[model samples]
Target: MTTWTAPAIDRRHEPYRADERTMLEGWLNYHRDTLLLKCAGLTGEQLRTASASPSTLTLLGLVRHMTVVERSWFRQRFAGADLPELYDFDADPDAEFNTVDTADAEADFAAFRAEITAVDAATAGRDLDEVCTVKRRDGTANEISLRWIYLHMIEEYARHNGHADLIREAIDGVTGE
Candidate 1:
């Protein structure tokens, strides 16, 4: 087992000082960067390797899934654009895990990077008080503030980064601050 340090967020350069929105965005950025760092220098096979029965998730799949999620939540839902889905939900929500082949490594990384770049652009110039609507899993629509979206994205990245930490550690016994 390996111990994981929480991702660091530099507050000094934040746009909003010590406000909740700035803190959340900073944390989200930190975790997103940390995830990319963890995947660095890993072979495609290592990135795609799945552990035993208890956990079928892989770092590669998580990367793919997170890319999709960021696009779906921020780019599509919040932005109110009808963007095409990244992965076919009708096939399997776990498609990222099952569909990854060694040959797809470069493509996957490219897509992930592109998604993040787009997300950054979409978020730029947006105020924390902006409102957005999203369809819930149960078919009900709820309006959300940009502040909530930032906070939720931060939490999502933080939780998944913990999983990435474990998976990367298991892959090579690598540990970091």
Candidate 2:
């Protein structure tokens, strides 16, 4: 059986001098691309291989986890779309990060890209200060702004991309931005 290999990512440079919205989105996209770059040219097995001992984190798992983050924050919370978790998250909270053993890495990456596209479309023309109230799993409502969402997602991607960097390095000694 042939394994899926990650394709190359063309990462764009984030602008240093840009408007607030542009800056936030650019950084978010930059980090997103960075994650893919870390996975680029790697086979499915390599992508799914764990990092150091005692940590099950994998590049494929990071991609899957980010997919859930994009979908949940933008579509489900911000746009109020009635969407279910893509990875049976409720049944297994870490399902997205732990179920890479048999996961189709190519399909997971595709779904991640699709979620980003959908969220971008769903948020187009939406103002940064536009606020939405989301009910937490505990049934408490909290208000969030598009601005905050962008920043939060940027943080999320940056954190996971760090993990990706280490995982990729462990996989084949490839490292750096």
Candidate 3:
């Protein structure tokens, strides 16, 4: 299996004139870039292949799922906009994995990239302390701070990016580390 070298973190240490907003933006950018790096050079079949038993998740599915997640959290929840869900939650939430088949890699990447662009546009000029209401999975509504949402998004991407690292490594004997 290939090993994955994590993306560089130089931006974390660099000085920025902007305040917390600048720092948060830097972190988000780092994670997003790393996610792309992990997907680089992978074939569509490789991207969709399951790693092992018990989990059907793949790098492509993660990309799809993350796009949905980013859109949900930032675009809908934070922006307080009534956006249509990307994937049908009525079906399996894991549909991203089960639905994967041989498809155009470029198209998949483009869809995922579009989600990122939407998220960035929705979040532009928003302050960290901004509050928004989101419907919880349990059908309860709760107010959440944008700062917490940003932090959670970063954490979510970071965790899934780790999965991407492993899945990409397993597909080929390429070691990034």
All models: lDDT? 0.76, 0.91, 0.75
lDDT of 1 at 52: 52
Write one digit per residue (lDDT tens) for candidate 2, span 88-134: 76778899978999899889988999999999999999999999997
Badly placed stretches (over 4 Å) of model 1 are 1-22
Clashes of each: 0, 0, 6
Let me know the TM-score candidate 2 reaches against the reference structure: 0.95
How many backbone clashes can be found in candidate 1?
0
Residue lDDT tens for model 3, 1-177:
223222233323323666787778777877877777777767677777787777887878888888888888888778877877765678876666678774455666787879888888888888888899877779999889889988898899889888887887888965552
Between candidates 2 and 3, the lDDT winner: 2
Could you tell me every candidate's TM-score relative to the true structure?
0.84, 0.95, 0.85
- Write down the worst ten-residue block by lDDT for model 1: 1-10
Prediction 3 TM-score vs. true: 0.85
Report lDDT (Cα) of residue 78, candidate 3. 84
| Cα lDDT tens digits for candidate 1, 1-177 | 112222333322234566665577677777777777777777777878775556778888888888888897788878776788867678887777777754366677788879988988888878877888777889999889878888788788778888888888998888663
Q: Which pairs in model 2 have colliding backbones?
A: none
Worst 10-residue lDDT window for candidate 2 reads 1-10
Candidate 2's C-alpha runs over 4 A off are 136-139
